[model samples]
Target chain A: SQQGEEDPQALSIQEGENATMNCSYKTSINNLQWYRQNSGRGLVHLILIRSNEREKHSGRLRVTLDTSKKSSSLLITASRAADTASYFCAFFSGGYNKLIFGAGTRLAVHP
Target chain B: GAGVSQSPRYKVAKRGQDVALRCDPISGHVSLFWYQQALGQGPEFLTYFQNEAQLDKSGLPSDRFFAERPEGSVSTLKIQRTQQEDSAVYLCASSLAPGGFDSPLHFGNGTRLTVT
Candidate 1:
């Protein structure tokens, strides 16, 4: 079963605007990681936020994690046409080797 | 570095037929994983391997699905009887380190399997 659930099943925005996506999960997690997938392509690791860490950044991608609420968010600044893709949040269940992924949020950046 | 590699980019099988998908992970990588992605959905965990050992396979949907990594490098996922519900993209990933919750996975493009 999917442990994480991303809000806003789909998002459409201007090329230069910022896009924010939210995710909520059940149970405690060792870490929450975000991934990006283009149409018909495999997943690309974005950023990982450990349970103890509140926030992290990679390039223009910022991720925030709130363990108390079992929620997380991903912010893409200055989105470009290239940023159009489906984004997913995966949870690392403590002691498990596999990651439980959410359905994902599809983002479309129109130029 | 060359990332994880998967073979038979596309496959078509009739219902009840057997099919095999192959994965060639990065050389010397200790962890290999398999995932299934349905249309419009994220990749779901199928199984995990640590070298030659079949460590975790709790994500496998049923007994008809089998996976093996005999030599600690190349892995194969086999489906005993193809079903329409089994049609999805099978993704292969590899991590350099063990399943220590630290290393990130590198994914391959995946093989699209269609069951008719």
Candidate 2:
């Protein structure tokens, strides 16, 4: 079964604006990772934040995890047209080795 | 010298036929993972390999699905008696570290399989 659920199934924004997507999970998680997919291609790992960590950033991607609420959010600052893709939040259940994914949030950045 | 790669970017098979898909992880990567993504759905875990040992297969849908990473570098997922429900994008990924929340997985472009 899928462990997480992302809100606002789809979002569209201008190239220079920021895009924010939220994910909520049902179980305790060891870590949550975000991935991006362009068109029909495979996923690209964007960032991962452990349960103990509240937030992490890499380049324009910022991830935040709130264990208490069992939720996480991904923020892409100053989005670009290249950033137009489907974003997913994959959760690794605490104590399990497998990663379960949410339905995903599709973001479209227009130039 | 490169990232994870999967063979036969796309494949088509008839129901009840058998098929094999291959994956080559990044050099020196210690962890390998397999995932299945249906249309409009997130990728679902199929199996995982830590080195040459498969640590997880609980996510595999049924007995028809089988995966092996003999040398820990190259992995193959073989499906026997394929069914229409098996159609999806199969993805392969690898990470530098083993068994931890810190290791990040690198993914391949995936093979789009269609069982008709």
Candidate 3:
């Protein structure tokens, strides 16, 4: 079974706008990571935030984690058409070396 | 430097037939992984390998699924007696050894397997 579930299965925004996607997981985890997939290709790693860290930032991307709530969110600022893709949140359970993913949020950025 | 790469970007297999998918990880990468992704779902873990050792394969759906990395650089995933339910995109990823909170995985384009 999948450990996490993402909110707002799909999102659409214009260029330069911001987009946010939420994810909720069911179990204790060591860390959470976000990835992006373009078209029908492979996923590209976006960012990872450890359980000890509440938030992280990478350029136009920002991620927040709340273990108490077992939830996480990904924010993209100044979005571009290039950022149009499906975003997924993968959870790494405590001591399990394997990462489980949520259903994912599909984002569309209109130019 | 080359990122991870997979062979036969697309494949069509008849039900009950066997199919092999290959992955070539980035040079010197030590941790390799395979995943299955349905049309609208996130990729699910299928297996993990550390060098030539198969450390974890708990995610494999059934005994018909097998994977191996003979020399630590290239890996292969084989499915015996494929079923219609087996149709999906198969992705391969690799990371540096002793992966931690920051070891970002590099992924391949994936093989789109269509089982009829």
Candidate 4:
């Protein structure tokens, strides 16, 4: 099975509202990273949180990693219409160089 | 020079036909990866290459899938005898090093293959 699994497969929120997505993994990891995909285009790197780090912030995005529970959460505050996209969580295992991705969370930010 | 580049943005092939997809990674990148993504899902690992060496290909779904990175720069993913179940987006990504702890993978726009 893929290492990461994201919750709330689909979400819809009004503009300016906050959106939160959660991800759970099954194994110990070196780092967890978040990516955003618009339509069918390629994924864009968003934020990354290392196993040793509890939380990280990038602009309007806040990511938290709880290695004990093997879970992570991404919080987007004050989202805009541009934020409507599919967000995925991928993990890099300490044992290998390849990254495994979660199914992803589809977010729709209404204007 | 510019992020990862993949050709044939869209491809349509008849069942049992063979198709090839190309990828040109950023110059100087040593790590390359291939992934398959079905509709409404995240990309799944397909293969990995370190320079000209294919270190891992455990993710390939079947023997019909073949990938190579000759000269350690450009890559090609070829699918022989395609099946309807094989229709999906083929993604290519590249990174500067093997660990990828310091450099995250840069993905291309992807090649959407439709097997009719």
Q: Retained native contacts per candidate, as fractions? A: 0.67, 0.75, 0.63, 0.65
Candidate 4 structure quality by residue, lDDT tens digits, A40-73: 7998899888889999999999999999999999
- What DockQ, between 0 and 1, does each candidate earn? 0.73, 0.73, 0.68, 0.72
Tens-place lDDT digits, model 2, residues B5-107:
9988999999999999999999999989999999888989889899999999988999999999988789999999999999999999898888535777888
Candidate 4, B-chain TM: 0.97
TM-score of each: 0.97, 0.95, 0.96, 0.97
CAPRI tier of model 2: medium
Task: Tell me the lDDT of model 1 at B2.
Answer: 83
lDDT of each: 0.91, 0.90, 0.91, 0.92
Off by over 4 Å in 3: B99-101
- Residue pairs whose backbone atoms clash in candidate 1: none
For model 3 the local lDDT of residue A97 reads: 54
Q: Residue B103: error of model 1 in Å?
A: 1.2
User: What local lDDT score does residue A88 receive in model 4, on the 0 to 100 scale?
Assistant: 97
Q: After superposition, how far is residue A80 of candidate 4 from its true place, in Å?
A: 0.3
Q: Where in model 4 is the C-alpha error above 4 Å?
A: none
- The Cα error of candidate 3 at residue B52, in Å, is 1.0
TM-score of 3: 0.96
| lDDT comparing candidate 1 with the true structure | 0.91
Of candidates 4 and 3, the better by lDDT: 4
Estimate the overall C-alpha local distance difference test score of candidate 4. Answer: 0.92
